[model samples]
Target: MTLPVDPDLRPVSVATADGSGAHYWVWGDPAATTTVVAVHGFRGDHHGLLPIVVGLDDARVVTPDLPGFGVSAAFDSGPHDVDAYAAWLTTFCRQLHRTGDRLVVVGHSFGSVIGAAAVAGGLCPDALVLMNPIAAPALAGPRAVLSTIALGYYRAGARLPESLGNALLTNPVIVRALSEVMAHTADPALRSWIHDQHRRYFSSFADRRVVVEAFEASVSHDIGEYAARISVPTLLIAGDRDDIVPVAAVQRLAGELTDSRLLVLADVGHLIHYERAEPAAAAINEFLARRLGGSTSGRP
Candidate 1:
């Protein structure tokens, strides 16, 4: 089946506790019995998960640009770490959905870190879907050591003046290389779009401070800790060739979550939802059917 672009996606804003605005896009039935909050990964906006959003049928799907990315303003109260995102999510949910609503959270990459933390802290979504989740970023290894160093650099760079930091981090060559690393699909058109998105959005952050805080949170986070505590029905999607979060890490994460199952996709990479949204959405839709009882067909 051919995937449709999420035509129902409409921009909406809600006030944070401190009265600042948080922007998000919503798709599907607004008053649906189930609501799926789709959280994008680091340096990504709502559009990143368009495929998955388009395929959602019987539930409302929300895509928000975590503070300091996309149209949302920088987080005002605290650091842009995992805890901060979780807190922000709690506030965001409270503002939109009632205190007790059937919420199914779908998080990708870094966003999964926030979701896992929220679930552990008792946000208690009916169903939790983690796509390309970050498992044990702090574990010891060459990759871990490199990640630590890179995060350290971001922390220090964030301390620098905004102009200086932007100049350093937003260098054209560096941005291009970063985009190239993520454009791993075999399809030429999708690969080109990925490169374009990296150039336009992923490489740029609204606040340099958010950059440092997000990196510090992402690298320091250990998903296994939160995974073990997640009591909600959970589904994990892992790309076989995922370079950022290795498939092995995802396998271990599945083992940690008591009620979780892992679905590994072949010939795919870190940009699982972006590159293979159909299959990604299909998996999520099917999972939701079993958990929430609904068809996958929807108005996109």
Candidate 2:
């Protein structure tokens, strides 16, 4: 769905502990009582979450291009593993949070894993929303064969020379193939837009090393591993048709969390942010209202 008008977005940047700059965009009112930090999936920037941001008119939304993606610089030290990303997220939220603001974390796909890890590691947001969360190992999912092939693809990209590796990783053909596989929508226009979106932003990573390391991190961990440790009320929005993490896995993840609600969308696949943004946002708004008692005004 196209937004009637572009949301007013303000660009902001912060220096992380690792010395890399975390670049982000702020949407909605700055003084809004609720603040949301929306994290995008692997190889994507802030643009992936814009549809949700547009629907969340009552809260201030912060969409960050995680370190090593989009305009953000890569970490000066350490591998781009779950722990490193969790630490970076902790520092990023702490720096952006303010007095009297209710902070909420919204993550999609790989970002959901990062959010869960960060929350389990002591990044305390008032509430958490995970869209298309990685609730099970990619290798164990129904798409295991694809996952294995992707593992090798990333490995080859990492080992190749810089120019060749970048070319292979960012190839339009491969990006479109991945997009077509994940996008379950039947609407031709929407499917085309999804492919275009992937073609546009799926290769914005800092370098081959960062993308490969991030891919390893994405496949290495799942939200279920950290669910029991998370104390905050959480919302899990899953596409029933998701091939990466099945709906059953997400239900199991909800049972593992201390307090969580699961919403499964029918006929939707892993590309909920692209195909089912309106429903996802509606659920998120309802969750925030019920759990955090925030404003529902369409002020933004």
Candidate 3:
């Protein structure tokens, strides 16, 4: 699971419209012609997308830790819902956007929903990339039963005492189990690394309230809700074996988008950023080159 190193990686922080401090990392050459703003999945930080960033060396990639996650402070106003997140993303992109850069927005899992919402709200980027996007309602997906179970789990955690709620939510055993379920890799080394990553960063949320509210937001909405409103060229990289959102769902989502291409990876699951970063990055590079007319010299 070792990834390519980025010597230029640096930390950055910016104040958002909601008065929350948005902490992020900038990777690759700052002078690169293309800039990608990457949003990580629920309960995850920028590290979850570093593998993909490693492969995207030709473009500047900015990975942000969404509000209430990692080092980013929670929103000072409004609930942690889809609309609030979309507004925050819009502000973040505007604040970090550089002149003469081909801006792109990339999101994974829950982040995809937020990205789509922002685009629908008029945050126009050169192109959009959704990795393992929740294309359909989780309650209607193949894993509806599991989603229902998770709903109860989050509800129980939210109803308990603050300390106990955080304890249940951050339990290492549950985190490993979730990681084991999402990760389709058979390599013991990679599986162990994925598990270790979850154990380390999955519980870094600001508090139980944020976790519960974000989970609710993640499951309540899907990318399809805003697919029609997204006018920019879009790229969807989905895993055929993804338990969270199957390839069929992603295909449907692609059909809904006005301008989009779908790339399905076989033998991969929900954790594409971890298990299939190289191939995913290859697809992304090709899509960007075609849509933005840029050179992908080191792609793949």
Local accuracy of candidate 2 as per-residue lDDT tens digits, 1-300:
675245234456555555788888887787787889999999999988998888885788888889999888999988999899999999989888887788999999999999999999999999999999999999878878989899999999989998898899999998988898888999999999888888888999988989999999999899988978998999999998988998999999999999999999999998899899999999999998888764643233
Candidate 3 — which residues are off by over 4 angstroms? 4-10, 296-300
> What is the lDDT for 192 in model 2?
91
Residue 252, model 1: Cα distance from true site in angstroms: 1.4
What's the C-alpha lDDT at position 45 in model 2?
Answer: 90
* Predicted structure 3, TM vs. truth: 0.95
lDDT over C-alpha atoms for residue 277 of model 2: 94
Residue 277 of model 3, lDDT score: 94
Residue 232 deviation, candidate 2, in Å?
0.6
Candidate 2 structure, TM-score to reference: 0.95
**Number of backbone collisions per candidate, in order?**
0, 0, 0
How would you encode candidate 1's per-residue C-alpha lDDT over 79-173 as one tens digit per residue? 78888788778777656664445788899988899999988987877789999898866535437766776676676667778788777666778
Sort every candidate by lDDT, greatest first: 2, 3, 1
Residue 38 local lDDT, model 1: 89
Candidate 3, lDDT over the whole model: 0.88
Q: Local distance difference test, per candidate? A: 0.77, 0.88, 0.88
